[model samples]
Target: MTKLLLINAGSSSLKWQLVNMPAEHVIAAGQVERLNLPGTIVKVEVGHQKTKEVVETLDEIAAIDRVLKRLITVGGVQTLDEVEAVGHRVVAGGTLFKGPIKLTPSRIDQLRGLSELAPLHNPLEVKCIELLAQRLSGVPQYAVFDSAYFQGLPEKTAIYGIPYDWTKKYQIRRYGEHGISHQYLANRAAEMLKRPLSELNLITMHLGSGASITAVKNGQPFDTSMGLTPVTGVMMGTRSGDVDPTIVPYLMKRLGMETPEVVIQELNASSGLLGVSGVSSDMRDLHDAAKSNQRAKLAMDMFVNQVVKLVGGYYTEIGGADALVFAGGIGEKDPVIRQSIIDGLGVLGIKINQKLNEADHTGFLEAQDSRAKVMLIPTNEELAMARDVQRLMDAEK
Candidate 1:
């Protein structure tokens, strides 16, 4: 049956999808949550059914083993060799990569070095690649990156207004995060709108636990909110996006802090919705508490407000956008937040049909084209990875 498994390795959670290779029908998908911690949970959704199990602490490699074992023993796969290819989500391809790469020893090591740029994501990604290669043996492994598509960004848009020579030495530029989701959303959104990608201008938002906004025009990325790091965009579940460059020196002088790295970690992991709301990072929990909780409401307001502001900025940057699309966990399900962001854009020809926005028919929410088309696309990044894998494998064939 030529099965392919796609892996998305987070800081502590590992998400996986097993699909019929070229056919792209998902056989099963699941998440190993809280890896390397006590009470780790393994949740799997097979054939539209879900089951979850909690186990004792297991290392990341152990978690991967357990998942593969479940797919074979518990999920009724006769042979592991049926898995034709494995795909990993590599977060910081930064200029070094622009698309998926078939894993080789050299390529794997290069990705490891890039981890310095995205400490929270790349190391884990490289580990997934390592673990998969160790366990799956002969299967071809591929890597799809989060910073890849943005590598083609215009030179002017990429180079910050700084000492231009430093850009040459450091190679620091806007290597936008969520490249996979945003890129997939941009293309899928074009398809749903029934327009050729080259003719469309879109503001694609990946509003998940972590979020970023991208400005796609003429089938290419024109600009994006994220910069050299994922921590540069709109406020996220726990990131301090777009802080003043001056804050570093001020904090250092005032508090006698050790280094900028320490403060930056706080910005990366300790801020955002969690910091503002003083609640759990999960949006569902925040939404439930927001009714009477003043701070929670304020946090949600800040999140929606920031997204709207970024959309406005990108709309102006791209001259004018034809449509605005949302994807990711929050973007797909949170209709109230979607409507809130689009409410002020009526004059700009962007208004969400309330019924279309509210109706959550299980998976994806494709809204009506009232003024500017509003679509709530549930991003299938694994499908995108599988498509890339097919393309690469075809070249070999």
Candidate 2:
């Protein structure tokens, strides 16, 4: 009875799933949110039952400890020893790691060096990995990187237009984020279309708080919106994406900012929909405010325009896409936003079945006679991590 535990940890949230290997059944899944704060919540589901509680946790380590204890108390597993291996979702592997690899002291140090590449994500993830190692001392662990899937991008697409020497010396190429979601969607799209992934051209859009779009050529990532970090893609909930580099110095001089850090912080935390709308960063809230406020309407319009522009450009770059996939929060739930994006692409022979989109048809939202197919495929990055872990384990035998 082999079991694999998968973890995806952020600064304030820790999501975990315990799976039965070979069978691939998730025996237990859970999450702890709002860590290191009052009124923190812990939610867990085992088999047919579910539980939620307000718990105290100092940080991600404490949250993880609580989760493992719950697994034992709920009889999801008799003991922690039942777990044979653990899989961790690492956000940035940088140049050292291009795929899933076994966790080790040296490799962990290598990941630490790349922390500057993903300042907001990697440090927290590393802390989780370290804590997990102490708790499950003997269990083998694997790091499945989100950047691994995009490592195969062509040189022309990956290189930045910086000084050639600086690019080579600093490794300053585009290391696109959200590769896990994009990779999962590519294969899922192939399965639904009844075609081999290797033969399909896909444009996968992951539109959440931190959003990115990927151009998958023949099932591999050919290009992506994110560069160097997740903050360079299309406009996100709070992130100022695709900003002109010169704006940094301009803002510094005009606003009396002391350094670039101050300007960058504003772009990361205060810009995007929040700055433009002067309301909420959430799409739902933005839509509600757009009904009454001009700025909110402009923010929503700008978002839709950016999405359409990227999709259109990718469609052309990829020599016309066979399918356009929508995932993540805004892409899956908000039908109005989805419809607006599709309507914007009507000039490219892409049409949506307004009735079907509004009526909750399964995945296919495109009109019957549309030239290109549009699909609603939900992404499961944890499952992707688990699958990669099992694959690496199988190779060991």
Candidate 3:
């Protein structure tokens, strides 16, 4: 059995899964949260066994070292040599990288240079890649990007109104995030609808803490809510999306701020649901508090409003969709949010069945005779990365 390691390194966390290829079954999975901070949490699951720990990791390398140790001890791996290949999830490939590629030294340098594009993600991902190169020198490693699926977007939608020279010199364009999840969703929705992907149109919603919607036409990305960065889309757990461009400079002067970086940090970390609710960044917590809290209710209302507007706009952009598919954390589990959004889309003749929405693991939520089908799909980005790795490896042979 070929053991493949899939790593998704975030700004403050790292998630990994070890899958047995050919079988395509997960052997073990784990994540380390709050890296380089006190009270770091690590969790691992293998077979029927699971373990959680609180250990301090001084940096990303130490976090990785802890992960490898847990993988061997709790995950049943005798040694790191058992893993035949590693796949790293890179958040921002910019325009330079459109697809998954082997991580050669020169390519790694290119990835490092693109760090300015995705400060929150690419640096840590590159650090993890470097660590893998050091500890497992012979293993073949791949960089699977999150923005790759949106490369073929229409020119009008990808380009901004900025000066042409600056746009070209700085590579300014809409490089949408969450492409791996969106790509998996488009294919799975086609399968569920019993239609060829090339013949189906879809509006796929990935609504976790970091949310984005995609208008997919015939298996390709037509338009997405996220722009050049993940912070440009609808409101998210902590990100303030779709803010006025002038707000940066205005806030700098108004708030007595000194730098653009400080303003950007506030938008990225201090805003979003947390800012609106003044409670928590988690939707579940917001939902629980909404019954008595006005701010929480308002936050929920704003989030649902954003989702409904995006769906309606994309529906028109795609010339009407065959189905509106929902994935990600809240989409799959939170029926209230789903119902609220569907209610807002009554103009489109979309109706939701209460029984179906309440059912666990239910995919079809649209009522009979509704104008379009509504589907709920659990995203499998790790599987998508694994499949891409397998494809690239096969092509090389």
User: Which is the leading candidate under lDDT?
Assistant: 3
Flag clash pairs in model 1: none
Tell me how far the alpha carbon of residue 35 in candidate 2 is from the true structure, in angstroms, after superposition: 7.8
Question: In model 2, which residue pairs have backbone atoms overlapping below 3 Å?
Answer: none
In the range 89-114, model 2's lDDT, one tens digit per residue, is 88899898999999999998888889
User: Model 1, 319-355: lDDT tens per residue?
Assistant: 8887787887788778888888888565576766666
Candidate-wise lDDT, in order = 0.81, 0.86, 0.87
Q: Count backbone overlaps in model 2.
A: 0
Which stretches in model 3 have alpha-carbon errors above 4 Å?
A: 10-14, 30-45, 48-66, 135-137
What TM-score would you give candidate 2 relative to the actual structure? 0.89
Candidate 2 stretches greater than 4 Å from native: 10-14, 31-43, 48-66, 73-75, 359-361
Model 1: residue 247 alpha-carbon error in angstroms: 1.6
Put down candidate 3 lDDT per residue, 346-382, tens digits, no spaces: 8999888878897845678899978999999988888
Cα deviation of 263, candidate 1, in Å: 1.3
